[model samples]
Target: MSYLYLTILFPLIGFIILAAGRDRLSENVAAIIGVGAVGLSALTTLYAGLDFYQQGGMAYNQNLWTWFNVGGFAPQIGLHLDGLSLLMTGMVTGVGFLIHIFASWYMRGDEYGYARFFSYFNLFVASMLVLVLGDNLALLFLGWEGVGLCSYLLIGYYYVNPANGWAAIKAFTVTRVGDVFLLIALFLLYQQFGTLDTVYIVENAHVVLTDSNLAFWTALMLFLGAAGKSAQIPLQTWLADAMAGPTPVSALIHAATMVTAGVYLTSRTYTVFEMAPQVLQFISITGAVTLLVAGFAALVQTDIKRVLAYSTMSQLGYMFMAVGAEAYQAGLFHMLTHAFFKALLFLSSGAVIIACHHEQNIFKMGGLWKKIPFVFACFVVGGGALAALPFITVGYFSKDAILGAVYAHGQIANLPLYNCLYWTGVAGAFLTSIYTFRLIWLVFFGQEKTHAHPIKGVTYWGPLSILLVLSTGVGALLKAPVEKLLTSAQIPVFAIPESLEHAVHGAEHTAVGIALGGLVIGVILFAFAYNAVKTIANTGFGAGISHIWRTAFGFDALYNIVFVKPFLLLARLLGRDPVDGLWLLVPALVKGGHKFTSYRQTGLLREYASSIGLGVVVLLIVLIITQVGV
Candidate 1:
């Protein structure tokens, strides 16, 4: 328990080591430090987890120091560990460690900034740890911004590419839109509750807050922040473009760490959301629409990583759907399973990209199954989990749990909209199967369109194989404790009457049928009707629909027209305005003065000595005049 801080310290230390050593450290040493740090953190998490269970699984708080005390408004530098944080910490370190291992191999030939890459990678993991482990909202916000900065650095790791830089900036700017909302929520909470301590806030919110208005606005603000980080709806365009970075960066950010922060935030502040049921319903609706939107977008993406990116958004939508229904355990469980399979899919795609000389368009890739049979197999398992293939995969269990919970909550609470959201989840699952298998078929089973180099190494296959194992039903063993821990901690759940309780199990079966039906249709469309599908896509209406979906239903265009264009126009109009000119003149004069003074800084010792002599002569003459006057 005392070693709780080490989970964050280990990676922070690794970041410093890699950053300071930079190119001086061999790739091998950097790999050891980068991967080993997360591995150690994972091991420490395991140790701490065992002790937590042994010691009765109560929440543990360690206050390192007081962060500040401004007129009695104080937040502490503290860490809190309970069932939720423990689960999040384990996933971050465990899945993150595997991603780091693959990154070492993926980045092998990157001679210029190999160490630099690991430094950013390690820092990202450390920041995520701080985010999940923080004791208060203030500390949580610190970690929140920490991951944001790290994401920017990692996404633009290939700074030589202008598009990559833009993608990174887009990510930073869009997520900041959410961060601003989160900051507002903090201010509103502090204003109402008179403290920024999270435990105190969550425990006493319903008790102290008399007005539902404060709760409603605060929860809504929190959801907006979560929506941005999770890439729901309008903020989602940046995620597809984020594929401009290396595939491992895509996996680490999209699959395991940064994107999931929003889900964690909403779940962490469940009490506040419970008080604002309207905002909760908004969360559920937002999730439903986002899943559908992102699923359609995923169907049209040709880049392998972009396909996975949209898929990540779609799956995150499911987690939000569950959380919005107050099914916290179910959402987190899906997140846990998603971390395993999504990382597997992304890493496998990275391997494929490496094998194919970095060709990413799936249409140009085919018959790679024989060349990289292992990667092909990896995709099958990971894709099965992603599609939530019934009964056999971890995703099926977790996703079915979400569908069940959403349905049960709706039925028990008599909310028609929640039931509608449940159907949306089912529809999202069908799309998941279609696009997932479409990716598998297009990339692996067709005629070989491109040559692929041999992929052979422990680094490449090791993490994939480990994640491959977790993508199976073996990982579903976590279901019991995950549900039990959250429920036992007094997390509120909708009570089901005896007569209506079967709806939960019924929803699970219906979801399975939909998944299987979608899988069969997916195989048929890609295998037997490929040309017909292509012809349809070439038709006017079909092409139009495909284009819209391909551009994520033109949300980007809408934003550009609605937000970007007007803002730019305003800037242009103000660029030479009379009032602006008055302010601009100040800087213009400062520049002119700088140019004049810079002329006197001649780089010569003789000129400098002559200037010193002249200054002394002037000073003596002034002093003599003053003495004569006296």
Candidate 2:
């Protein structure tokens, strides 16, 4: 429990130091505080993890104090350490430490925004920790909004760049749609169940949440919130544009930490989703569609970070698909595996960017494999892992398990829907292989497309190397251990069909053979013939195809026409004070009355008395006439 508090405290301390001393502290000291805080927290995370395992990964709720209370309701401010939170906290702190270390080198000599970067970076990690660790949805939402605000600040870290500011605003606006849905779900759950505690709500779901429509929409809203945070489907456009920030920002938010929050949200509240099968079914569909759409989008991206950004979205789709199919273990496993390799891709790309004089277009890079051999080796491991190459990479096992789950789940449904999801996932896998290798070949394969640029020692390359190792077979070794922990924590495993059991486990020779074949076919189709692919990529037809995908299937444009333009128009209409005319008549009448009364006053006491006497005489004459008529 003490270590749990320290996990949050260390990062907060780093944020304070960096923010308060942004100008006073030298870069070295600031870097130490920034990286050291999370580094120490990582060590503490391992300590907490060891204890959690020894305790059989049982759930522990640690409340620091009562945040507030009204009548009988008290939303405790606390940490909930269970199998899911334990793994998430460990991953966030560990991978975040590596990113911080990398940023220390990556952000060197920015006399202006150096400490400011670390400040936002530190707070970002701390906010995510609070998110996964909260005891109740209220605290969780606090953390959720915290990360969103920080994302806005960090994404627009270069406030001077109007484009960057717009990117940040886009992220905030889009995600807020989902956040509203989440808030509604939270209120509904509380009113129905009288509690915001996740454990309590899950336990009482069947008894208190019997209203079908309520449960369905609540679950749907939760999914929407997760989609916003995780950057799935309709809410996903902001993430790719977020690459306007620093590379480490891209790695930390898009690659590892922030984008995965949706998957975590769904998995954490599995029971709530279980109460609403319709919503859960839609979750699978969203996942399948997102994976396929983003996979194609990744293929056409020229910027290396944008490629990884879309890849992150696609990977998140796999997790959503798994959870949607009730494959909790599989979804969580893919999430963990994605954290390693995806971060590797972004971090490795950072080195290549710095080495190539900040050039991002892979078409502009060539023969860099020799100049930056370290980054080159790292990219192969990361790209291969992302493509889910057979036995050697971690993604093969995780992804195979998810696809098997989709197939099995579909078979149980006795419908084509799950079958569609299964094949869509497989197609995405193929597209993933093509785009990832396409990136590798175009960046590191032939003649140097651009001139060489120098890399700062191994300072940044070092973090890429660590993530690279994790992206390879080294991370695969953890799958079994994590899977065991997940099972013990009562996270249900998907029931694989007897015919496909070997595929999920990665144990059968035939399954291994198929994966290897896919890997070779992917390399052949996308990477082997570099010159031919390049020629087509530069041709008119190819340019048209790229244009379609480069606009992200016209989703951005569609949203602008659909949501953005209308909202802006409404804002403009409201800004003009359209109701002011309705209130103008009252003031106009009052002013006229005041002018008539002033005319009657005549500026002297005798004049005022004479007017009063004339009014009395007129009143008397009218009275006499009325009497005679009577």
Q: Which residue runs of candidate 2 sit more than 4 Å off their true CA positions?
A: 456-458, 497-542, 592-630
C-alpha lDDT (0 to 100) for residue 610 of candidate 1: 96
lDDT of 2 by residue, 1-630 (tens): 566888989999999989999888888898899999999889988998888778877787788999999988899989998888888898899889989999999889875578888999999999999999998999999989988988998888878889999999999988998899899989888888888998888677878878889999889989999999988888888989999888889889966578888888898888889999999899999998998899989988989899999999899999999999999999998888888888888888988888888899988999998898888888899888888877788887788778878777877777678878887887888778778877898899878988877676566877887888888878989888888777765677777677766544443233345545666765786666656777997999998888988888999999989988998999998896769966887998999999999888768999888888999999999999999999
RMSD of 2: 3.9
lDDT, candidate 1, 251-335, per-residue tens: 9998789999999999988988988999989998999999999999999899999999999999999999988888887888899
TM-score of each: 0.91, 0.91
515 Cα displacement, candidate 2 (Å): 6.8
Instruction: Report the number of the highest-lDDT candidate.
Output: 1
